[model samples]
Target: MIIIVFHIDSQERTYIERITQDTAEGIKTLLKNDLEKRITSLSEQSKLSVISSGMSQSDWDAISKNLYGTQYGYQAIGWIDSTFHVRKRIPKHNNEVTIDFNLALNPPALLTAIKAQDTQQRAVTMPLAFIHGDEGIGIHIPIFNANTRGNKLDGFISGVLLFKPYIKSVVPDFLLNEYYFTLFIDGHKVYSDQSNQPAIAYAWSKSSSYYLQGHEWEINVSPNDEFLYIAHYKVMRILIALGLFITFIIVLAAYTYLFARSKLKDERYKIEHLLKNLPGMAYHSSNTINRPMILVSDGCENLTGYSRAEFKKNRMLWRKIIHEDDFKRVEKSLNEAFKVNSPFELEYRIITKNSSIKLVWEKGGPVSSIFNGEIIIEGFINDITSIKEAEADLISSYAFSDAVVNSVVEAVITIDQHGLIQSFNFAAQVMFGYSADEVKNKNITILMPTPFCDQHDQHLAQYLKTKQTHIIGVGRELIAKRRDGTQFPIHLSVSEIQNHENTMFVGLIRDITKQRASEEQARLHTEQLAHAERVNALGEMAAGIAHEINQPLTAISLFSQTAKNFCEKGKLEKLPSIFEKLSLHSRRAGAVIERMQLMTKKGQRSKEVIDCIFMIKEVINLAESEARLRNITIRMTACDEAVDVFVDRVQIEQVILNLLRNGMEAMQLNTCDNGSKIELEIKLNEDKNVEISVTDTGAGLAQEMRERLFKPFSSTKENGTGIGLSISKSIIEEHGGHINFCDNKPTGAIFMFTLPIYEKRSRE
Candidate 1:
């Protein structure tokens, strides 16, 4: 009896030890999982709040309050700035003391924060005493500047984890009552449910270790007095009582057999209960054509919406529930597994009794039933519908993003912090003459030319280090190289993308080669049109120029003849005066010829600063002869101060001349009873710009004519080419000026134009 009692006690002790070990392991897992979730939530919040460069106090307050509201077991949640100052704390009624508190005073917390920044990862500090006299550990998650290129630490999202409340929340209620648990962090006892209880030297106890954030955590679990009495002493006393009631040998044999059978039944019951409560279904099935299930857990109803009895009664029901598209593959896998007597795992779709589809993952192996010595299948089937759905959603999102990027006309390229190409859209591939695969993972400098390619890395490094931007978020026209070793102009605009892991730069690029070509073509066409109009204007003024030149030539002829006659008649004294008149007349003719030549010259338009008054005077001189011949009196109004303007001399002169000639022609046609007159005025307007006006005493323009006045191919005169006014408008606009015509006070037309005043810096 003593030997039997000793053996029974030994068995009880073994079972108790096993249970404690499992409990300790469970507690450790729960703590680790809970801590991980909190860390992840804090990290995500940190990322969101720093999107605008730095987090405001209100931002921190909102984030901390939200976290505190959603979760429990935190003594306090707060934000710490880069300077180690605690800027904001939640549950402010009690935690106000922590506000503005510098973390530098707490060596452990400060070290943890520094470690988090250095590793760019979340970290936890050693156990410490909280201000409220609670024992806890601090967790720090580093926040970084999202706009910057590097992982520059902006601050930390920190939380104080109260050991007692935290551990109570994680450990199941049933476990707390049955077992005494003690938690240790780095060999320091931080929490214990029963402080008076003996340590690990006790017979029924187990210990497990968990590593988190550089801290070694240990959980020791031991059975309480009630559990110890039930598991060990009670069973031993009952067996001893039974041994005393019967003959020694018979009682010994009966007790041994009954105890073995009872233990077997209890173990079986435990396994069955565990399987029934599992999150997924477990099954034992016969290896037959339809794979009829011999046993199925209660979880069958939850997972498949069918009872275990239904699965057993209808052998073909399980086979029918498999999705049509996936049944064949499932069967093939099972058949292969049976052939090799090996385990098999598969993921496939199934339809529940309610006709709802689900994705399930199954793991099974062939097993021989002990009762009948027949091969059977034992397996676990878990519903994985949510996981599969999440995967599909992620894939669809990526596909949609890719479609949008590739469809854009502008090339899209993304590069990592090191300037290595990460993504190359279809447009980028076509623009750069390289395949997506060829450019992926290559340095962005590969698509740049000589100096840019050489300096690209240094520029990127500098931006990352200093967070100073030159081209990021700004557009620039730069040279880019193609796979064919050709360089072309490209307009590039870069933007930064930041996440917890790293920084990325997205560039929108346009190949401006064709755009540049088109602009050059338009410029050349404009120059041609202006030159053509200048020549045409000279043609129209041919008669006026000839008459003006004739006067100067005739005067020279008369002077020279007089000089010769005086010399012949011995009038030497008057000869010097005649020679002087001759020289003056010759110079007058030469000046007219030079001005005409300048007007006819055609070349690229070059702008320079010149006095507006002087330019207008030259135009009047050329038009004066024509004005007089047409019975028109020309008048001038001048400003006392010189008005300087930046303009092409020839272009401005052409515009002025065209307006003067038009005024003369308008008056000639009207033939007013009062002698016709044209007024030319140059003065500064309110805007400090040079304003030139020409007024003609003729019939003013009609409403319809004014609307299309500046348009090409529209004119009001009888023998007009219709291009003079259009060319004049273009010339004025090109020189940063505008021309418009308005009605004169009484039966006349007034044409006014304004030119921007040139500053000295503009000439440079």
Candidate 2:
């Protein structure tokens, strides 16, 4: 009995020793591997941060927080500059005091950092006390400037690893509970969980070593009192009771059988739980024509709205549930897969017990039945209705957007940040004289003219870099080039579309060639209309003009006669004064003719600065004789200051003369008993504009005539051409002014117009 107990004890001790050795090796390996992985990750991150430019505080904090979460062994992660100054640290709330700490204060860490920088590699320091009172080692990863040719050292990413927490983290709780451990670094004990009590002499112990980053770490593992009591002493006592060995053997066999059965039952329960929680249905089916279901998981009810018992009772239930349209395809796929003894995938619709249709995807393969070794099919079916619906929605969205873009009348173009055209709509194709295929992937500069095309790329790059916009979100009228090499005006509005992945520009372009042409034609027509009106006014004043010219001509003729007589008489001394008078009369006749010529000339309208008061005086002079014939008096009022206006002189004169003539005619027709008068006033208004008013003491306009007063071809007088007021309004508005008529206080009508006061800057 003693020999058997001794042998059992020896064998148990040997077994325990072997387990202890393996545990020690495993712990050492786990610690080494975990540290190496963490250091490698830190090194890679450090290099990436440096390559990105420099290790900023945010970058450092991000890396530190990530390491703190994933590499939990680290007490703190920090950045040390090239000068060995601690610039940043993790767990900012707790470790903020460590920032700006000089690494020189800790000789070991400083040495490690210096070595890492010099060699441009990773280095580690010996275990030392950190500022936070935790004993740990420092891991330093060097960073260098990638942009420099010399690869100058930049900084170091340092991680402080706590001893006890690191060991506890790497070693599993089960292993830790059964075993006592001692951690050593370079032969010096750093951590040990053994109490001050003298170690048990019978405890099993083993030591294992692992090397990492030039440092040697040893883990010593030993079974505690509980493990020893159960595995060695108690077992020895059991072996000593040799008389009950047969009974013990019988009981052991039964226990082994029951334990195995319990284990199998537990495994089955886990599998059942897993299938119940599965997102869809799992099934086993017979490899037959109908593919009858042999077994189904609990999820079958959720997926098909039918109980498992129903599927078992009705062998044709699966076939009946398959949509008629997809059953044949499903059967064909299954047959093909079965023939080749391979896996199959199918997507089809199925009708649930409630008569609702659902789209399902199935992936299955042939397998041998454990009970009979017959081939059977097993598969998982998942509802994919939502996925299919989402796909359809996405496709429809894209199609709708495309249709809308193409339907617009203006050109719609989308370009990537690089200025390459990505999409060109139908309008763009028609406007630019290019097919969508021809312009796609082409630079947007192809549609721009001259210097703009050459500078487009540079401008785009500048905007991307500086984010300063010149034309984005703003509309500009610019010249655009067509495929035919013709340049035309286009109004382009560009908008920026930005997302996380990329930036794009959408350009809306409108071809304004026809619009510009129409405008030019309108301007020419206005000039012609103004000239025709001036000619007509001159014709109306012909009699008065002839009478006025006759006086000057008659005087000139008399002066010439007198001068000729003086010369004939040889009174040369008196002839000088006679000749002077002749010159004055001739000059006066020339001035009258020049004024007439100006009024009659037909040409493009040219604006020049002229005094408003002076222009009114000239108009009155021409119309004075006509007014006198109509028995109407013309009066003028002016301001002391000269009000200069920029306008076409002939156009303004025509407007005033038409007003004067109309007033005189109205008074003649009305035959007012009181003397009729037309008053012209020129003054500066509050808007700094030259305001001229013509008041007529004749019959005032009626209310009905006011509405259509400025409309062409609408007149109150029987012989009046309504175009006079219409033309006057157009001419005044064109000169940045307005004209309107209102009833005077008591009687007659008042015609008032204002022209912007001309400044020197306006001409420029």
Candidate 3:
């Protein structure tokens, strides 16, 4: 792994360069450990010098205040005791100060007085000065002031007579021991033992008297001579105790050595006795000799049915006892141990006197010349026939599992956690249209569609963390992308297998595309049959009703023409009577034809993009005669411009005509209605499809007939054909649209159909 640091604003890069040109040799030289050792030595040296000097009790406070310019503060460097102590070393003009300031406790400093000339070691002194007062006043301050307000004779009495005579009799009581000197210059510490170099020094003086009334000091000489005599007495005592301790240790070691030797001999005797009576073979060999020889114990004869005399002198006899197939393996095992200077263990077969193969477990290790005068291999062999048979049974179990997987009808594929394809059964090859050789080591995402390819790794990571999987232990139907780039639906079942630390998944997939296609085709056929029935029933109703009403309609038209002709010829006196007769017949004939037209429209294809207003006007004109005969008026309100659509123009025109006729029949049948009228409206829809609604004010469909009204052969009228709505349904659906019917407010039914307006693509 490499660490690359880049500045986000400037894109400037810096690399941690590996400048150790002899990197391989540096690794072999253990350079990191060596560097760590050197750093530890420097840290220890700094610690030892500070601890030995007692700077806390002397002038550390004065030195720190002058040098660091702090009355009291601490700097943490490293551990001083179990708890880490902040050791502050302050360098002054001529000497440095060392202080252990542990803030956890209200702490004090260890002080050492350093003479400027000697800066390497601290000077040790004892009981330098003593002064006393009545309470806290003179405990830690100067002795006195020099000037006094008094007469000359009175000053002489206080100074020369009283204080001056008392000062002449004072001296120090204690001595200074092992005094060494140190100095500091320009923040660097220099010691007296280092060199006789130019440096500042401070010396201590013994004051005889303080004139504070009988205060005294005395300094002792010959301090080192007295200390050396005391150290010699302590050393003699320590040597006598150490001599006793060494004598005790020597006695204990000699007793333990003899006891351990005796116990080891007993163990060796027990092992040799056990080997003689063991059920299997035991032997030792010396490979270090010019010619290696095998020493066979008596138990070897029992295992191989060969006398030890025959094998001991002849190493070839040992090979003869091994089965022919096992001899090469035994030789290989021995050669490997000698090559690596390690141990050897193997299981193979040997031949006994009964002419049967016996499984043997053998283990050996190299040893120095102890049992013999040469380096040797010593081992024991055991019969392992039972274990060999158990292993054979395990192999048979795996073979059965393999057979079951191959026999399955669905495609099966196995992939490891890394998504590398591990195994693909024969059925999988055929289902994916890939040969086994082509897919091995390929990513499983080859079978996934685009977005799935991008998101599959994220899905794997989520499942691994949560231990939740959507596809495992359950079957799902999903689309699988094939090698040919075509997609088909499949039912896939996945199972996860974890062995040791490795995770794998097995997917069993079966193609279901053909089955779904067959079901869809059947559904469409059923719909067509229902539509055919509706059309046939409506045709029969229209034919029957139209045939019965046609003669009456012709008679009404003839009488109306005759009355109009007489009126035009100036027969005014007879006009009112004839006109009344003409009107009654005309109204009755219009009602009969209106019923016929509603049920009798036939299917015909009409393709056009006719203006919506014009189409509605033409259909209204065709239904006008029928409407007039029933005293029912037809109304139309259409958009000024044409709203065109791609459609079978004739069929839709017929549909409009049928709706007008149905509307006239509905309004004429209701005697209580104020106006006998039908309205047709055409308008553009928001989605660019044209909606045509034909609403009637006729009596609405009966509750029983409403549910089944558009079904094949279902009708409410005695002379009704039930095929109109069903046929209309088929026509609209064929144009990629739909038709629906709803109750028209307080009465009648509203039939509505939508067709998309045609959009033409421009040529490039």
| Candidate No. with top lDDT | 1
For model 2, where is the 10-residue window of minimal lDDT? 46-55
Which regions of candidate 1 fall more than 4 Å away from where they truly are? Answer: 1-388, 407-409, 416-420, 441-480, 489-505, 512-519, 559-584, 672-675, 762-764
Number of the candidate with higher TM-score, 2 or 3: 2
List ranges where model 2 is wrong by over 4 Å: 1-391, 416-420, 441-445, 450-479, 489-507, 512-529, 573-580, 631-633, 671-673, 762-764
Model 3: per-residue Cα lDDT over 626-732, one tens digit each: 56567777777676667767766656665676566666666766761845667777777787788888877888677887778667667665565666566666667
**Ordering by TM-score:** 2, 1, 3
1 against 2, candidate with superior lDDT: 1
In model 2, what are the clashing residue pairs, if there are any?
none
lDDT of 2: 0.84
Per-residue lDDT of model 2, residues 575-606, tens digit only: 77877777887786777778778888876668
Taking the tens digit of each residue's C-alpha lDDT, what string does model 1 give over 457-526? 9999999899999999999999999999999999999999999999999999999999999988987877
- Using lDDT as the measure, name the better of candidate 1 and candidate 3: 1
Candidate 1, residue 354: how far the Cα is off, in Å: 12
What lDDT does each candidate get? 0.86, 0.84, 0.55
